[model samples]
Structure formats: C-alpha cells, structure tokens
Target chain A: MAGSNHTPIKPVHRARLDNIAVVLHRPHFPENIGAVARACKNMGIFHLIVVDPLDCDLTRILKMATHASEDVVANMEVYDDLAEALGPFNYIVGTTARRGSQRRTVMNPREVARELIPISQNNRIALLFGPENRGLANRELKLCHTLVTIPTSEFASLNLAQAVMIMLYEIFTASAEFPPDFVPRLASSFELEAMYDHLSRTLAKIHFINPENPEYWMMNIRRFFSRMQLRARDVKIIRGICRQIEWYCEERVERLLREAGVNRVDPEGDCEDRFFGGE
Target chain B: MAGSNHTPIKPVHRARLDNIAVVLHRPHFPENIGAVARACKNMGIFHLIVVDPLDCDLTRILKMATHASEDVVANMEVYDDLAEALGPFNYIVGTTARRGSQRRTVMNPREVARELIPISQNNRIALLFGPENRGLANRELKLCHTLVTIPTSEFASLNLAQAVMIMLYEIFTASAEFPPDFVPRLASSFELEAMYDHLSRTLAKIHFINPENPEYWMMNIRRFFSRMQLRARDVKIIRGICRQIEWYCEERVERLLREAGVNRVDPEGDCEDRFFGGE
Candidate 1:
C-alpha cells in the first residue's frame, strides 16, 4: 500500500516435510488425546505415537476427537518403553511451556519450527510429549541433544493438547508462509476472539469463582495469562482447561450425589460452588 | 554414578517386537527414521512406518543411530494419505514448531510422549512425520488428537531426527523417574536465548538506532542484547541479525544514509565498547 516499491519477497529455503513423529508419554486424560488428534489433522501432521499412557482406549478418546480426525485416532503406535518409542530418530528437542533449568534452549513456537524444518529434510524428527498433570522430567530432557521451552507465564500452564496445537500451528504456518518476511505471521482478529471466548469460559470453571462479585479473580487470572499475551495455541489450551473443569465438576457432583445415596435437589448451596472460598 | 543405589535406567517401553508398526510420511531424509529406530531399539520399540518418503534408505540414516536402533529403520510402513496411515491409532498427537490458530489443542513433547505408552498398549499406534523443508502443515497438525511442539530455539532450529531423539529420551527417562511430581516441565536456558534473539534482532533489523556514526556506532545495541542475558538461541539470533545487517545496510544504504546509515559499524561508540560506557 505504501507508495514505495519494496523488495520482492524472497522465497526462503524451506526443508521438505520428512519423517516426523510425535511421542506421548503417560498421558492421563482421553479427551486430551482426542483433541491432539484433531490438532494433528489440522496441521497435516498425522503421526501420533503414544508411549505407556495411563489409559489406552479408542472409546472416550474417539468421542473427544470428533470425526474428521478419526484416522489419527485409528492408527496410534503404543510402546511400553520410552526409548523403544523413540529409537527411530537421530536428533531430539525437548519442549517445556515454562522456564526451569538454565541448561536447555528455549524458543517460542515459531522459532523452533523455523530451526527444525531445515535439518529435518533428510532425517526422522520425533517430538516428545509428557502427561497431562506434569511435563518431562529433567533427566528426560537431559537425554536429548537440545532442550526447548515455550515462553509462557509462570502459572499459565497450557493444557497438553493446546500446547501441541500452538507449537505445530506456528511451525506449519511459518513454513507455509513461503516468501520470508512477506506474509504477516500475526493471527487475524477473529482467531483471537475465539480464544477469548474459550478463555473466559475456562476461568469460570476452574476455581470457586463467582461472577457476581468476581473482581480480583478474573483480573488475576487474566492478568496472569495476559502477561504472557496468550497466542492462538494458548487460547486452545485454555479452552481445553475449560473442558477439563467441565468434566471434573460433572464427575465430582455425580460422585458426591452417589455418596449421599440420593440425588437431592440442593439448589441454594449447590448452585454456588464455594470450593476455594471455604478453604 | 551412585553405584550402590543406582540401577541401569530402565526403558519406558521394552520392545515386544510385535503388533506394532512405525510409519514415515514423505520423509525427505533417512537418518531421522534411523535415529527413531535407534530410539526404538533402546527401549525395545520395534515397529517402523514411512509414508511417501522422497527417499527411503536405511544405511544413510543408520549411520548416526546407535547399534541396536537399526530395527526402526528395518521395519517401515509407507502410505500416501496420512489419515490412511494413521487410521488405526487410538490416540494421536501432532508435533508442531509454531503456535497455530486458536482452533486446535496442544501439548509439549514430554506430555505427548508421557501419554503415549499406555494408550498404545492394547491398540496399534502410529507416529507420523512430515517432509523436511516444512513440517506437517496446519491441516496435518489438526489431524492428530493434539498438537505437539518440541521446544527449540528461536534462531538455532533442530534437525528432524534430533526432535525425535529428544522426545524418545524423555519417554525413556520418564519411566524410571515415576515420582508423581518428579516431572520437570519448564523452559530451559535455550528458551531464554530465543526470546533474547527475538528482541535483539527485531531492534537491529528495524534500525532502531542513532545512525550518526556512519558505522554501527550506537551503544544501545550492546546494552540491549546484554540486558536480555541471551541463551544459545539468542546467540544464533544475534548471528541472524548480523547476517541481515549486511543485507539491510546494502539495500537501505542510500535511503538510510540520507536518514541514518551515514554512521559507522558500531551501534555503540568505541569508548563504550572498549571500556565502561554511558547510561
């Protein structure tokens, strides 16, 4: 749009997509698996390797994956040993969403993709994923050649699936933007809006937060995440958190009612979940 | 090191060498899969699959892999449609190097691998890899259950095989260190470098400097990069900045000279570079 004619956008040297694999270690939730499958399908990365998970079944996972990515759901490789699962690649990069050790290298999603793509041209690349509750151990990270971490707020731990999607999407988009520096890498406003919806809902579910007088709660949570300036992948993770909370609450309520031996109607107190407030 | 209490670190999944298949998707290089095979062999995982690889040769890849890992290279599955390749996976996760749109969920490499082993126990799991130049596209990432990103540097990217090895090593280590809260999921020193690189290069490339020196005569540049306390990635990024500097100087020399390029090669003056400088 500027009056000046700019330099022609140069085509960057993008490595061809090659033998790429993702390994999941000891995952806890099935829904997360489904969501990850959907994420892989969205990014044209269909290889899903699940190593020694807490649960292994296509049942709940399939429902979570929806329909389009049933193929990924259909073909998953399971291995008992993490080493066995990873014995096929030469190079490895460990990823963490937050900062811990000073030994490993870190990058936001975009940079890792840019760096990994070129070297992967003639090799098999395997990206490892840990379980839902926690992430890779320091020992695990030590085994790999290079360590990586995603820049995020200290407390803004992204859901397992959301982390995957953001990193993959960034890499793919970065690579897809053929002419380097030509196409803007920033997400459209629409994408950000979808994320906001997910974030607001997720926050509502996690704590004993009451929207009626929810002052510092939202601000603190938003403040925490906002400090990170959450990107698209982050939003997806927040959405997953909502799903988890929704599931957890449902399960907790059912169990409590079952223990009570009757599904009594306690609307007055039940309607208001005073979880953390009582604490 | 601790002989009395130390046992050989156990593999997460010992290779059963049955009912498993490893597949590669349009692999441009052979070494990555070979490395994957090496990882597989390490933990007793012995199934290999390749999908639409530009070239499929074991020797080229096996060179870098360990002695026992050759099996991953031996058993390979090839396919055209990734969906078709991973049609049987009960769980799926896509590895990404970027943050995608807010559509898909994500996971770090550790979490994904952590979840994989158990999920694949009773089911067939498939780990998919994209081409070399560009990783799995956005469409591909969406295919799997979750998007997985192996943390890498903002500037110093990893090779495809390297990404695989890191994920596998985590899976292997995670098995033995099964403490509930033992998993260390946080950014490593490498991550800091990437962030620093981003900040530094953006400043340098944009020429946010006082160009009166006719050289790189500004001290803000040094102070800026120093203030960031760069990681390995930052170092690479600074190199990238240096690389881009020449191009930027050449292209915008005329324009910048009229505006600012009239300065010398020091963003900071020689006195400051040589000794204790100004604020």
Candidate 2:
C-alpha cells in the first residue's frame, strides 16, 4: 500500500476565495486580531486588514494564529483609515450587531454568501467587522454598500472573531458549491410599459374597459402582471395578442358599416379619446 | 399631541423568551461571559449558565456588560458539569464553528430561529457555547440533540462572545415579531395509512389497478399522497370519495351480472384480496 503509485488530483481552481479580504476595523485585542488571521487562513482568504488597530503585540496575535495560519499573519496589512483600506475593493459588506431606525435592513450571512459569489468573480470584495466593545461606528458603516447581521437571540453581543467566522463561513459555503441558476432574467421596465400601453388601448377600443374608471382597472391589471416575473419573450407575446384583437374588432366594424349602405363615415374606433379624458 | 391621553396598550403575555437559557461551557475569559450576559438581556433571555470557567476577573465582565445587563451577570449560574447545567431545559442546541465527519449537519441561525419559536412556547431550551481555545468537546456535543454552526469561510475561528451574540440576535429577531402561522396541523401517520388502504381497495374494485403489478403502481400513489401535508378533515373527505366509488361500481356489476343469466352464485366481489395480495 505504501508503494502504490496512485496520486490524488488537485481540485480545479474556482478562485472564489482569492478575491476576498477580511477587514477588522479598530480591533481592540491582539489575540482577537490573531484569531481573525487564523480564521482567514482557515477559509483560504489571504488578505487581512486591521484599520486603526489598538497598540497590540504581534506575538500574542501569532500565538493564537498557531503555525498553520502563520503565513496569513505574516502577510496581514494594516491601515490608518477605513476609506484607504477599502479603496481597492469594489464590493463592501459591513457587519453590525445593532439595529437602528435609520439603518438599512441587513442581510443574514447565508444570503450574503450566495450573493457574493457572482460579485467575487470579477471584483475584489471586503467584509468589514467592527470592534469588540461597540461594533462599527456609524460613520464607518456609511462607507459600506450593504450590511450583514448574524441572527442571534435577544442579546446580540457576539465576539469579534465569531462575527468574522460567521461571515467567512457563509461566503465559503456559497462559493464552494454554486446552486443551479433556476431564475430567468426578467423583462426590462421599458418592454413591460410598452405591453401595458398596447393592452390598455386594445381593451378600450373593444369597450371591454370603462373609459370613466380606466385608471382603477388599469392599475389593477398592472399589479397582477407585476407580481409575475415575466420575461422579455412573454411581454412580446402578450403585445402581439393585443394587436391581433384590435385588428379583428376594427375589421368587423367596417364590414357592418358597408352592409348598412350609409354615406356617413364608419364610426371612429378612436374611443381611445374617452380613455384619455378627451385629449 | 403631547397632551393627548393615548397610552399605548402592551401586548398580552407570550413569554417564549423567558423559557430559554444561554449556556457557556468552560468559557476562557470573564469579559466574554459578561458580553454574553448583556446579549441575553438584549434578547430577553434571563437564564445563563457557565460550566467550569477559567480564572478571570468578574469586574472586567461587568464593565463590558454595562449597567442594563447587570441583572444577567448577577444572576448567572455556574456548574461543574454540562448535564447538570442543562437538567432544567427540555431542548438543547450546541453551537460549533467547525464541522467534523462525526458531527451532524448544523442548522443556519435563521432556520434555527424560526424552529425555536414554537419550541420555546412551553419548553425550556438551552443554547450552548464552547470555550475560547477550541470550541465544544465531542463529549459535550454528544449531549446535544441539535447543533448549529455559523457558516464561515475555511477559517472558522470566531471570538466566543461574538458567537454568543450572533445566536442571541437570531432568536431575538425571530421572537420580536411572530410570523403569521399559515401551516395547518397535518393528519397523523395513522390517519393517512387508513385512507390509503381504503383508496387502494376502491381502485382495485373499479378495475383501474392492474392485477399483475399492483404494488408498483400503489407504491407510486402512496409516494404522491405522502408528499402533501393532508389534514384530518382532508383524509375524511378523500376516504368518503373512495367509498362512494366502490359502492357505485359494485352496484353496476350486480345489475350486469343479473342480466347475463350466469349468476346462480353471485361473484363474491372480493376486490380487497387483489389489493392486499389475498388478505
């Protein structure tokens, strides 16, 4: 068995972890800093940024990091300002334990993880964790485009390293195995608007819609279709049906006028004027 | 508006949070213990347990905990053993950052939060956290009926206090506003089986089931029905339809046999035997 010549093949590179940076903003403890570095190593994330860190011992950081993650500790970057630290990254996510009335709704780690995969493909992403004592300052949080909160019991005071681990875990799990893309691209707003306009005019010409209360009924129809994530092809098909119906009804009206043998011009199918408040 | 006498009415008692305990096993630092207590207070959890903690300063714990969480720190209980600490609790959840081959798949915090709401209604539940150096021991993990791991990158190290806070935050958010219950109580397994037996016999009597491979078809039918969360009322209605179909078919068979003039002894019509394999 020892002499067996079987070699295990290395996994093909996905490089999801390569573009991610774990940024600890104003970390208080040296040991916490070391733990963050170890966690980054565990998750295959090499870049670590400690912003405006407290005066801490590198020995304490390395001790907690152990030999396995010493490479991460050795290559860690330090910055004086949050903006400078985040300048290289395109996508930024801030983690906070507290909620406020003015703050945007936060995504849970799992949701963020799945979302970051596509973002990480072409751009550098930063995951920001705040200090142990009070979490990120409001000014620092303002720089982030999105926020992530770990769901906890009523007492949401988690240690800094734990928060870092949760975020990394989610991103790793999401990146490791991608889910099948079942969601199709939806129609753009312009296409949907054109379809709606065609439908409204067709209905009015056929007198299926009441000109007096067209707004109310049209609004209801818009609501119904908006709920269905219609595709571009679906919008075009619907518009085509509306045009056919309009043509069919108008042709029938012209044939009926000719049978009557009247000299007057056929009734104008422009009942569309009534819908637009006699425009 | 200030002088108006419109005092807000408080919600009625739904003391789900009161029944939960956050247990920390052999927590290394005293400050983390204080932070966890503060988190419990933030989430409305009153009970806390620390098992054989490391020698640490209580002042540091309280100082970090602040004044609002003083009650949590003062009332914290210490235990030498995990089982003794969890004796009063009916449900146990252990938190781990690392997944092992021996460990079961862990629930993400949000999923656990929704699940725990109904559990916390009448049962005493505990959320257990491990020590700072390495997390929970395997022996301690064995005592848990369920495990929760914060999704992290390959590097899964998180600070103990942070882990506690994330867990508490989830429970708190889930408990703060209850989602409207849309799921009805499902029919018990026994009720469902009885309905299936009746249905199979009816199908056999009506000549819809093939005699040679009746089990193969019946198994597929059973699989379809098991997927639906049928209620007791739904089972009753389905059974009624099966009975009616059996009666109509049996009556039609008797009329046909009488006209054929070959019914000196009526065909005993034992369709049950075909379904039950000669029951």
Candidate 3:
C-alpha cells in the first residue's frame, strides 16, 4: 500500500467521455434520473437522455442531483420513443441484469469500457439503461450492438443510479492513458520477408539446413524471430551475419580448390558432399 | 464486438464482501443512509454502521432502503463516536473530495479495492464516508490508515450513496478471478549465462563478432534476446544452434588443414587470418 505520491498520474482522454451518452430508456423515477445525472457528472459525462419516463418531475430529480449536476439535468434531452432517442448514436450498448437463452451475448462493464476506447474515437456511443422495475426487453436489446451486465452477487439486483455510477466509473477510469513504455517501430513485412529469404539461402549454403523442404525448417525460424519482434536494425544485423557466413563459405571453397590444384569444381555439389560426409 | 455468450462468468469471492463494512460519519439525511444500505446490499456488502447522524429515522431510512435491502437496515449498527465505531476494523479507508498537502497519499476507489483483496482475506475492512456538506476532515482522515478519493470531473461533488455504490461495485467486480493465461517458466540466470557463453564462442569462431571487444557487441545481443523473454525451451534451441555453428566451423578448418598436409595447426590464428584477411 505505497502512497500514490510517487505514482505518475495518467492523462484522461476527455473527448471519449464526451462522445458517450447515457440514455435511460423508460425510467420510472425522476429522482433516479437526477441521481443518474449526478453520477454522469461525477464521472465527467454530460450527455443525459431520458426516453419516455413514467415521471419527469424536475423538482424531485433536481433534489437528488443537487447543485453540482444541475448542468447535466438542464441540458438533458427528453424523447418520446427509445428508437428516436438512439437515432444519433453510432453504437449502442444495452444494460441488463436478466440472463436468458435469447440474451446470449453479455459483456461485463469493465470489458465494455475497454472495448469502447477505440470505437469512441470516431463514433457517438450510447449506454442504454432500462427501467428500474424491468430491465431492457429483448425487443429493446435488438437495437443495441452490444450488451453489458454489471457483475453482482446472488442478490443481483442493483439500484438504477448505482448501475449507472458503476458503468460510468469504469469508463472514466479506463479513459486514462497509462504511462508509456515506448517500443520502437518493428521491421515491416517486406523487410522481414527479404531478411528471411537471405537467411534461408545462407543456411542452405552452409549445409546447416536441408535445401529440400526448406520451408519446413523456415517455419520454426519464422516463429523464433517473430517472438523477438525484431526492429529494422535487428533485421539488418541478422542479414549482415548471413552475408558474412556466405562470404566465409565461398572463400573456404576457393582456398581449398587452389590448395588441391583443382581448376574447376561444382562448389555447391562438392561442398554439400564434403560437409555432410561425416554424418 | 463479439457477444459475451462465449465469455465465462467469473465467480465472485463472497467472503471478501462479508469482510467489508460501510461506515457513515455524521450523515445529514436518513434517506442517504437508506440508499447507502441498498447500495451495500446490491453489491453484496451487508455491514452498515452510522456514527452521530444528524437524523436517524427508521421510517425515512426504510423508505430508501426498499424491501430488498430491509435485512441490511435491520442489522445496521449506530455509534455516537467515529473512533469507537471503527475499533473492530483492521483497515479504515477515508473518502474525500478535497485534495491537500497533508492528504498526499490519495488513491482512487479501484486501486483501493484491488489492494483490499489480500487484506480483506484475514481482516475486517471499513470504507468510511463523511457527511453530505463536507467530506472527511483532516482530523477524521488521521484515524484512517489509507485515504481514497472517487475520481470526478470539475463538479467534484458526489452523492454519499453513489460514492458507496461505486466503492462496493469495484470491490465486488474485482473479487472475481479472471481466466488464466499461463506463462511457462523462463530460463534461469545460470541457464541464460551458459547459452550466452556458448553463443559468444560460436560467433567469434565464425568471425561474426569482434573477439577483442566481444562484450560491447554482446550487450546489444543480450538486449535483443532479453526482449523475447526466453523460456527454458527457447534457451535450449539457441544453445543448440550455437553448437551446430561450432561443429561446422571446426569441420571446415579440420578438412582444410588435412588437405594441406598439416599434422597440427594453430586453428584459431589461421582461421582469424583467413577470415579477416579479405576485409
């Protein structure tokens, strides 16, 4: 439990939070709406949409929302229909507590928060919360691109504002960028392909690999190098070693021929026989 | 986005929840107390303690606690003093909205929840919340071993129940264990040193590294291989390659010497001269 005094503070991507709109579909209580607004404001979310609420009493809502979240309540949009409310958003995530055969795909809030980071860059995302008494129906869920469930105990029922608070908390926390551990740009596919080709030829020339079915041995070589995630400089270093091996092998063959007083020789065929003869 | 139908549900450690108690110090409203109780029950935390409340009406508290959370309200503890209320708990976390020089060690709720998992296993942990108008004072915070602040926007004021809900939600969700992604045992320092030594000799024999200052070049090589986080099997593979290179260099030098009718030769000196002479 070290103090966070030494820990670096991560920068929050505020624009992502701005892109998220909290839509309460068919909410039953005005106090819950106000509470949701406060939760949204607490987590840096401003867009609050209420669709066809049973009660839209501003006094009760404002009471729970308090003065701090009044702006969220002031600019909040009220819609007559759920589909019309979600029309402007590019992506919709429906929240549900009920699990059924029909609701096959359900993600937890943390996973949804992480996944939304990329999508929120260019899209308006809506987090749709259903009425307190009954969660989003299968019909309403159909409009959603994804589904999220807040994990709870055997008493799995959560308050409307509580659910909203949890979901928003995750998004707000996830929006922060972790302290960077810089990894340099790795070699491109084209550069890697050329290096691998050069390595294949050099290994064959040295009789370190079978010329026949070279691809089989190359597969293992590829996996090994892939794990390294070699940068361009590493690729160049590997290629230089291959070139050196080729030069050494050619020079040895020429020196041997001169010593034996042999004018002509199939270097490849002769070297293969001489290298593998002992084996 | 893939459907979570394939995602396995993680089991929540309920005993951890049982170990957590939510303490309200000098609360203003009974409604907030009731809401906090519901929030605790929603997230599987049952223990609720109130200390020197402005008002503690059972009727008003029960109204917000709802029938679902009645059991939590029935077993709630009330205390006149904060210090006496926190006596049974081994760890006390004070929540604050204000940041100051004295309160330099503030953690967000998520970090606190994650940290509490191990501590909660053997000890009782208390999450202390202050009154609605002013959060925990510096004097009250002194009683706490650690301090946590709910991260919020410019409008930092958050409802008491919302704050309680967020803290409990984090604990409940974090209690679940994630699916394991196993990493095999890596090569020990002794094994890695052996591989590096073998590699150094093999590279020198092939004239791929400068023998005069091999360690300088070996530093870069070490960094490259370290990035791969080599396993025991990977170390074995690398050592095997070094052995192959050593055998190839030796075989080539031996055959060349025999053909030249040399009974014994300074292999290292001759190889160095022959290899680097052209360069």
Choose 2 or 3, whichever is better by lDDT.
3
What's the candidate order when arranged by decreasing DockQ? 3, 2, 1
Question: What is the iRMSD in Å for candidate 3?
Answer: 11.3
Docking class of 3: incorrect
What lDDT is reached at residue B147 by model 3?
Answer: 88
lDDT of 3 by residue, B181-264 (tens): 246688999999999988777666566777666676678778878888787877876776666555655566556555555543
Q: For candidate 3, lDDT tens digit of each residue in A62-176?
A: 9989888899999999999887788667667789998653424477888878777766776678899999988898667656666788887666778899899989988888753
Q: Order of all candidates by TM-score, from best down to worst?
A: 3, 2, 1
TM-score of each: 0.33, 0.51, 0.60
- Model 3 spans with C-alpha error above 4 angstroms: A1-15, A176-279, B1-15, B178-279
After superposition of all CA atoms, the RMSD between model 3 and the true structure is 16.5
Check candidate 3 and list the clashing pairs. none
Q: What DockQ, on C-alphas, does every prediction get?
A: 0.01, 0.10, 0.20
Per residue, candidate 2 scores C-alpha lDDT tens digits across B1-279 of 664558654443233788788899988888778867776776678888899898547898897677778888889898998777876665677888776543254677766777777666656678989998888877676556467877655556666776776676667666425443443444544565577678666555543454566554455445334323345666775575455333433443343333443242433423222222211
Model 2: runs farther than 4 Å from truth? Answer: A1-15, A42-44, A63-68, A95-114, A129-142, A147-159, A173-279, B1-15, B42-44, B63-68, B96-111, B131-139, B149-159, B173-279
Name the 10 consecutive residues with the lowest summed lDDT in model 2 chain A.
A270-279
